[model samples]
Target chain A: MRITIKDIAKRTGVSHSTVSRALGGNTLISEATTDCIRKVAQEMGYQPSAAARSLKTNQTKVIGVIVNSIDDPFFSEILFGIEDAAQQAGYSLFIAASQYDLIREQNIVQTMMEQRTDGVIICSSSFSADKGRQLLANGFPVVVVNYKANENFNYSIYHDDVDGSQQLTRHLLALGHKKIAYLGNSKSGRTSLDRLNGFKKEMRKAGVKINPAYIFEVEGSEPELGKDGLHYFMNLPDRPTAIMCFNDMLAIGFLHACQQACIRVPEDLSVTGFDNITLSAYTSPPLSTLDQPKYSIGNEAAQLLLELLGNKIENSNNTHKEKVLKGSLLVRNSTSAPLQNE
Target chain B: MRITIKDIAKRTGVSHSTVSRALGGNTLISEATTDCIRKVAQEMGYQPSAAARSLKTNQTKVIGVIVNSIDDPFFSEILFGIEDAAQQAGYSLFIAASQYDLIREQNIVQTMMEQRTDGVIICSSSFSADKGRQLLANGFPVVVVNYKANENFNYSIYHDDVDGSQQLTRHLLALGHKKIAYLGNSKSGRTSLDRLNGFKKEMRKAGVKINPAYIFEVEGSEPELGKDGLHYFMNLPDRPTAIMCFNDMLAIGFLHACQQACIRVPEDLSVTGFDNITLSAYTSPPLSTLDQPKYSIGNEAAQLLLELLGNKIENSNNTHKEKVLKGSLLVRNSTSAPLQNE
Candidate 1:
């Protein structure tokens, strides 16, 4: 027969409540009592039941992590961060992939709630402020990653995309490139809009007018879109001298297309990318990209959710704060001065 | 006030147990009664508590998946399959990563047991037959993935690694490669041993003498190990013209080393990898590899566990069995006839 906490309490001549407190390592319990109970529990080989304890405390110590897709390397790094932080806090994680489907996101959220997960950290593409608010209203702590909906919704962690994009554009401008093309995700998302706005702002700051024909948008996160974007720009009557892509995946596709066309990187054209995934370093010519604090963002989000579960923060209204992480530009072999002929 | 089953029963003029059966869509209940109860429950805006129902039935409709590490793309692909299949079966998954630590694996198993998880699917690297026997003794339905302990414990889902490696070696031999080297993982795992046996068997069948100096063992899964393996082999007086890696990651590392050394793939040497990951296709020269059905293996494991949970399978000792999935060789840009000279 399996040993139970009750048996340990009985053996230690302590009340079950006191035994529970001691086993949980509550500071309110006397040190001597804690040691005694712990010793007895160990001797008896008693294992605390997570389900029974959760029923009494209303906290499962389980964090639900929902990602847009698991196949993407960017999100995988973020998940690693979240898992690392969660493990440090004596918590386990339950992961689900939304697969970029809004309905699936909703379903996953509902399932997490049904599981009575103490909190959730979401790296979703289509999650809305309204949904976050609904969860908050239902007493669920949620931390949104990589996207912010509204300032009113609490617990959001994102990179400063606008600033990051602005810096990237300025670097290109400083390199003496005047005709620069932007390849990015569709404007449906706030992230894409922010990046676009930042690129335009940087261009205006440099006293250069934004060229309408130099901007292209892709509908999804795939390298093929990047290839298509490159093909579209290259066919223009006056093609830009350089291209800035939304992410490294797109940049890689662009590079592959250039390779196929016998166009050398940093020679015939210079290209830059965002999100310095590990693969960025291995690509031919090595991609010059933005290094977003992907892992730290995930870690901080998990930390915030842990705080909420611990009741370190009171009330949902006060938790409606945004944490924006900074990004950096990693210059590798991919970018250089534009050709003098171009 | 939140509506409960009692309220629904009262409104429907039926006993609470009958109402529960009807609302649960239990086959024991009449179809007309189920319809009536469901209508009344809907009218009352009654939501069934999954937790409460689970407590009564002892079935959470949740499967626990424990993986050795989530950082590897191989494990990630397997997880995707498990999650997809579980969702389709109206079951939810709770994932835990052990980070390749044995203690963490044990703790995860204990936690899953405490949660009353219907069944478990473990894709672990360090589990022993003793642990498997212990779990079986405790009446837990477990499907081991990627590793098998003993025939005493049932329900294993794994690819034919030995056969897969043999096929890979034969492919290299058919390409007129006389000197073939084996690049494999450390001797700590059965997977590595199986692959080594396959490679040796194929070489012996081809009447080729095995050179001990040509075999290299990587201490870990790090890409740097692959580079080191390549450098070690290249420095030898008699370097093999063809190299067969234990897996795709090692192959990628080897490829990276070749790129750095300015050694052209399939020209200076031919290379092959196992477990054809998505990134394998994007690697320079692409990778010729064995396509393991990682996702399908996970799906089958989950399905087996679910069947065990539903009592659909016989629990008799003799009824337990292992399922082996076949793998195929994916010929890509990485391999060709070896050059006339090194």
Candidate 2:
């Protein structure tokens, strides 16, 4: 059996805390007590933990990872990638959820600091500069993934939301969709704005006048948000022929809502979504969405953080500190040529 | 800014390890040297990490969580529950995926031990007692959720697979369906057998003899497994009217396969699944499955671990060390009465 401080405390008749303090070389403890505890600990063959090595070398071989939520399929895929990369690099991840709350983000960061992780990777998009200031001031290494702000972080990996949105919009336009609505996620900050801007830019290029009333932004980006968006559009007197959603989750909710309302997709309305999560393909009629390459994003983010920690592995792409990958448009059963009802 | 051992080492012109050893009270170091390093650490106002507190109090306020796969929706929902419960008790989670590999499971357990987490919760059903010997021999606190094995573990929480299976079978029988098939996962050990036995018990109770050919076992439990099961059932000369799956993922795959073959659910065939995961509800026709109370299982598992750690919260149920909860049958669009043939 592995021996611990409690075992030594039991043998030496001292408190476990005293054994810990004496072993830690805390000067407040008398030399006689320290000597007695050390001798007993040595006799018991107590092995020092990696944490003990951490105290000596100042490296714990652990990385801190913060995500928006654990159950979200999008983040889960990303986490799978992160875990694979970190494991290969001989590092374990300390995972925490921020749940898109500032106080929680700060608290998680603080906890990571107290744990003295070598570096941190933030997969939560809404993580602000203020929440990360503690780590920054200490010259701690951090790599952000798909974060809105680009000024503070020296290393980051993100998907090109604007470009991906334009591709989705262009596909709809090519299919003869003139009245296209953009359903966005207001909580996603810059991601929402970028996708919206991309839709507007693509419309301008096609010489199409935008219907401002057709564009709507909701507080969330889940399937429920998409459901709510469908209700709003159905009530609109001049609802667009096609609706572009923020992500796959919202698109799924919209499709379910359509099914309940007896609206035939592409026959009555067309729908498009960004971030092609795994479930997107299994949805009824499958979903037409953008392939976000979530796993790759996470893998690259961990690699970037590893690089920042000065352990750049051989043959890694280390040239760019900031990387923005584009998403591909997947045309599936959820979208097609809208009914010509001029 | 938090001053670390490196800061003190830099000021004293000594290696960080020497500074660490000197401060930790290692006897190998000279008395004068230890005194000097301690004074420098004090002068620099270096804040001892929570790890230091861990050494003193024998607690790190961290819990290690092991799962079969990080991205599996079933496990993710359970993780969501564990995270919520751990956070409420001033604890953080260190999550790892075992991927159902024994070596990986052992490695993860070793890593968690090395980190000195207060306790561990194993959500991986395949975790063997031999793999946990390190933690066990050291008298480490462990709580398992839905583990197949009952021996060697004092605290465990699991869904009543047999009872849930019977409930699902009874529902199918009530629908006047006598021809039923069971699709199980080979890797799930006792869980698969228990569920299969439950189906058998219910069928026998109704004076129905099950066809050995109607039952099939696959190596996996994913949606892909369900799809493969469907192919096998479809080729059989005497295909059953309804198929009962081991879990929600497989059921989803089966439904998708039916959709591809133009086989209308509940009209040509009926399907049911266990562990009513969130995605199960979003399937094409929705799913008629057993709700396993995944979140509650996880929440209670963490709470049980907390109790084992001797921090039992007020009003917490600490009555049973071995608790098996029953699943409820959810009848949706999947199962129905088989067409009559004379």
Candidate 3:
């Protein structure tokens, strides 16, 4: 049975044009008329063709989200928050995972643009910043989440990593640990650099000289690196009694390494981490870490993007609009005063 | 400056209709023309309206996913797998969280249908089985993930929960645990029932009487419930020396409760959990669990949906199709032989 706009109009007691407008998803139509038309259309099992419609109104109502990796809990939570808000606003999301490859990220963005997405949200790696800026310059309404690009031309939403790292370090200092080590990813991006600086700043403020040997940079946040960091520090002639890691994944890894080495946590050594993921509390002797408001960050990013797409705010060349949320240190069972030298 | 297809046609010395057809995202156009027109469109900053094009093609190229909860690690990983496969197929995904509310699940499906989504993937609570059947009856292409419904009219992709649970119980039995306690959610769904039945089947096969006192159902899968489950069991006159939980979250809570009570894991009592999430390995003494292929399940579901949407296969109601993935148990530090006294 063929279903048509005329049939829907006849069933709803409306003109074909009105039925067409309602079926076209035009918000300008009366709610009652649109509802009536939609009911009749659903009853008739009518399906509108996407190809012919693109020729008339140039909007797809689909938002594209490009992320570096979806396996990370942090990014996954952000994606969930974005999906929640997008669903509420009656928009569908198309996601592309670039797997931290610069060329892949660029290709995904270009593809989304060609697909005629309404807007884009990018969580890119350092290698893709240039391409990201180009997309923004091309007048694509883009929102950069988590990563802070060296080139500044787009809207960005990120947690205050610098402040969060400083607070974590301060907590360690207050615990009477004079020699503290900073374990983090390779200083390749702004996030790592900012965190390293924050650690140094807090130590310097406390009149403790920064020990060059105490700081370690690694490749990834896997448990092996954490174990290697522990092994490296444990062998040092004058190893610091405490260490602070860049994120929780590293901390958990380090914790496991400590157990393997028969080194007790908060006893033989004190360890701290950032990003208070759900697994933190479940770890044996729970982990002490900093908590980033991941959900809120995603929520705000979507809210801001919706404003831009809805024309609720002026799209001007203003450089002062930035949303920087703060992170908090959550004390758990992992950190304590170093054991007295025995 | 208003850039239009006519301007691009004039610049390229082509007919406007040809340019429109070329830029209309039709695959029938030659690659050369599509490439030339796309290059010209990009150069001209031609933004195609996806909203308008979807009206004529009847193909939004979008899939709607409704899950019971987004925060659960199991569901999140499944979603990631789905997103990966969908993105690879050039399809977009829109996700909705029902929070296990039947009414909200129905509402979300209705909205997705109204938007004329190509298909939907639902991981709903068992209480919504009737509504799910109604959706399938309405000619919506749907694939149920994780949960099975009453009527087998739609596609279903899930793990072999019964086999996995029985394997876990048999493992505990081999470890010299005769008195085993079952800690799980209320038996209001097929998943819980299946898991419970698997345990009972294994126990009966071993010629052990099923102890009604050993099985306790909690209100939810929260930390509080874990603590309550422990208290309820520990208060019994003849408490089991070993316990098996429904999922990792509950296992974590149970472990925390044991910690507070000073119960030595693997020494006084052994505990096991299903769903070996990344956190399970990080827990203190690590949680022994059944590892489900969460990501693979999601990937297969998306792949199946894409195949259906592309009309790559014929629909045969008589053909019975089911993809049941097997799960393996990872023996971590959490499980051991029962204590002599208990």
Q: Best candidate, TM-score-wise?
A: 1
- What is the per-residue lDDT of model 1 for residues B166-248, given as tens digits with 9 covering 90 to 100? 99999999999879999888833888888889999988999999889988898876666788899899999988999998888
Interface RMSD of 2: 1.8
User: How does model 1 fare in lDDT?
Assistant: 0.80
Residue-pair clashes per prediction, in order, are 1, 2, 23
Higher TM-score: candidate 2 or 3?
3
Off by over 4 Å in 1: A1-46, A128-134, B1-19, B26-48, B126-134, B312-318
Most lDDT-accurate candidate: 2
lDDT over C-alpha atoms for residue A154 of model 2 = 70
TM-score to true structure, per model: 0.90, 0.84, 0.88
Error of 1 at B57 (Å): 2.2
Model 2 chain B: ten consecutive residues of lowest lDDT: B311-320
